[model samples]
Target: MIMKYAILSQTKDLMPTLGLGTWQAPPDVIENVVYNALELGYRHIDTAFNYNNEQAIGNAIKKWLNDGKGTRKDIFITTKLPHVGNRASDVKKFLELQLKMLQLDYVDLYLIHVSFGFHCDPEKFTPLVKPTGEYELDMETDHIATWKKMEECQKEGLIHNLGLSNFNEIQIAKIIKEATIKPQVLQVELHAYFQQLKLRKFCEENDIIVTAYAPLGSPGAKDHFVNKYNYSPDTFPDLLGHPEVKAIADHHGKTTAQILLHFLVKQKITVIPKSTSENRLKENMDIYDFELTPEEMNSMKKLDKGEKGRIFNFLFWKGVENHPEYPFKLSDDKD
Candidate 1:
């Protein structure tokens, strides 16, 4: 089984191009999903503190290791710092908690999940909400300070690779300018519809490996927003069901999901598409066997709708658009 990889500039670590994304995955079933993914040859697993499923994922990894399936060094585990813990003071605290929950001495990659901050209760570690039902915004959110603390943790050998998620180029530049160590990866919402060409180019020049979250256009996200916040977008992207994508899939004798993933993987853009179904998991990994033609890749590139194609604006968090560190532009202006 051949697999593509992105080399981290700092340590030259080979991060597998395809990984298992675990956002919106319920904790109850996450253990089995993770265990099944490991059995199916997945080496990279992406999770976050806010996902609240790290403990279960830890159980799966622990069980797999105990069964003598693989050692910790063989697997790459990536988790993040939650928005509530976005402050420099909270970096080590939350990281230690995540390590404790994941039952690991260190994580392969630790990312600052978001650029913004949310005020939360210290004891519960839950984001505090205003009486108006909006998130309590932390106006003084400081990226450079938080990033400095992240570098300290990396120096202490707690995090092997340090990265950012949902951070724009400007925010990343600020960190790079202040840091002793540069960020090795940038995980963002990337798909065929919302291809971040300019951002990817910037990362390439900076030697930051870009990881794509919601790589399948996050088909389940609409329902999640509606159920959790009673908010729904005017339109939801269905990249897997698009006629153009289907045609490409049929041409290659592959599923639409496979074509979507292969299109990104072929470009050396890491993709973490989430799935619980065993068949889909295997299907997603089988993409390495086939290659999309140059013409097909061009056609796929035409699907880039830019900012309008973006699905995760984080608007469901009520007043999040007003945050000082909000990465996306809320109006007609391009980010």
Candidate 2:
């Protein structure tokens, strides 16, 4: 029997629970990754304007659509609004560029990539940095206004639904309370180690679909962050080496990554595991074949460290943590 899986958003859209993430996917390799993922039954493809691989993704999608593999409607495409384009007026402009790059007239979901805004050079779309070597932020950032613009895009058929990423529960609540069109989804870092139980429960009660970006604990996230942004490697934990996760994997005869993903899917959360390796890509989608016992679920739940387990705190952005809307505050339970 074919196992079916999906997460229904507030708009009643059926998003495939498993998706291929395109973050940090090199341009030279992304096209093939996209093609292979589509051929291997990945109907959900996640990309972002900042990923700089939309053109490559567009190429792959064009080829697949031309080959009659699937129609545009069969694929659920999600992209984000970059920090520079986080303003109310720049919303349509940035999405139009992404739509053009992705070779699509409309996207299935468009998200506000970050809560804070950046001062960018519109000509090159590069963010301006202050003399202190920090990103130049727009102190007048207004997410409510930005979200209203997103609603306009939806009404104009530029996008099917709206959502937010890297936003906190309070931020989401603010948007919901002030929004004419409620956010349909919320994308954030999620794994067994940092299950985000409180936020997940909030979204569940609010009818918002939650998507996990680093579902496998982002095994190499530490190295990547340290090398790229001068962050301390100690900020990230090794999820694959966790004793509880290893035991669970051994019991199920699966890799630790698969067990991590399976645990989240069991909670009805959508996940996007990014990998350029063909084997890993296939393995990421191979979780539906088995079910974790209730005891195994409880064991996974024990791994949660609440706010302390968060990896992408965005604190490396210098004064970004000081922003009023900064999401990853509180080094403990209050967050």
Candidate 3:
């Protein structure tokens, strides 16, 4: 049970830079993949309560930590808050459930997933079931209030750091303006297709660290954010197949994914690429030893064409569309 640790600025201190992404990853697959990644020196793992693998993830971490590779302190872990649990009063209850599922005392970083709110219609659906859900914003309570609850958890030692996911500038501004503690990190969708340079700049100026998911521009197809947002990863040539990427892979004797992960880390942006395979998990961790040149970095940066995407924008939580800060915008170049 060896742990991989890389320095990343979480708040005032450095945390492990690379973490395993568990979005949409199934429990059976994630268990082995996580263990393998840890064995390959990956200490940070990213999971969400919505991912439905919290218990499995908790089990894996518990086993690994107790197997003599190291203690929980040696690993940096993160889990996110679900959109349905966005109310101020419900935040702690949701977290407590996640903890019970995770079988852990605390999480390293806890994030508020989704910015504005949710949009849902349980009555008129193919799956037609359950209580109606609405935008947390339209409900009349403030996200800042919910965030305050998150901060209280931080004070209570339920989590080590507090961050946000799917939050936009105005909402982030509100949090920053009213927060007893400003958000330490932000995890967002970023890749060659949608670099989000402007958002990145704002976070950087505010001393907030960013973690880039969807680095390969995937989980974006016919349904979900990739489609609701109208982004096609297939539209962009796979970086793996690019001649420049190929040459670099040959030059460094690494794979394309390694090059991509390294590209982000070199820019000081933490990356959490999701893969449920043992080989891929280990391959991702093998990135720290290499460095790409300034010219090479610029070449990769040229890949931006402005597309926002994700595999799961299922909208099950309801009324997400009304939120001004919904991650994808109608005006974005959806072609």
Candidate 4:
């Protein structure tokens, strides 16, 4: 029953490598999902302001604590600053609001949700869009100033660790140059298909622990994007159904997901795969009992699809690729 964890370089805090990802989780169902996860021995919960389910998650954690299941100190909660709150002036305001929503005095980690910013009416909490259906860009969004504010929040004990999501190497380097405290984590899209080898190497050199989102290649994302944004790529990689992965899973007598998760955790990379089923939740955390052989690990490594393997390009934001701080180059634009 040994659980894996990564120690934050700055705070020496232990973050459970396997966390429950709450993105796209329905509000009504999330409370029960989170509570069940805690009962099943999950100690890390990954959420975000834009996810709009923090209150539900908070209620679950509150119930778990009230029932004497666990103390607040036993769980690590990670939330993020939304794109609308990407500037220095808005960091404290949003963090306080998030704290209020989560009913917590402090968060274990707070990440800047993305590198780019968007103009939005604060009351609505949705990005302001132009007549062309594109989000109104906040071109002057300043990463260094925002990082300064995050550092200040860390000093005030509001956030134990500060990190970034959806930020590229160049954007991260800019922050590191001006940071009094460097980022402790970098969460991004990662799976066998899109391993992010270069970025992981860079973060490794900088002592930033990498967390893999969509660790199963996010099988449901294509439909989600199509239904919501009327967009879908010509092709999407299916890691779960891959023949190589299945063969390995069959040999190991484990589920495809367990194999996928173990592959990342074996490399010391963190993974947060989203699922609402009680059985799947329990199944996800069961990877600790087994280990992947080096040959099996390398077999999965060959599945890397590089840039084209990426599913979350943020193109649904409609002209985001044109933004100065857009972290990814379009697949067509790549050499």
Compared with the true structure, model 2 gives a TM-score of 0.96
In model 2, state the lDDT of residue 205. Answer: 91
Query: What is the lDDT of every predicted structure here?
Result: 0.92, 0.87, 0.73, 0.92
lDDT of 2 by residue, 102-173 (tens): 999999989999888788986889788788978887888899989999999999999998999999888999
lDDT value, candidate 3, whole model: 0.73
After best superposition, candidate 3 residue 78: deviation in angstroms?
Answer: 0.5
Please estimate how well model 1 matches the true structure, expressed as its whole-model Cα lDDT: 0.92
Candidate 1 residues 17-128, lDDT tens each?
9999999898888899999999989999999999999999999999999999999998999999999999999999999999999999999999999999999888888889
Which portions of model 3 show Cα errors greater than 4 Å? 1-11, 119-138, 219-237, 307-319, 333-335
Q: What TM-score does each of the candidates earn?
A: 0.97, 0.96, 0.84, 0.97
Ranked by TM-score, the better of candidates 3 and 4 is 4
Off by over 4 Å in 4: 1-3, 332-335
Candidate 4: worst 10 consecutive residues by lDDT? 326-335
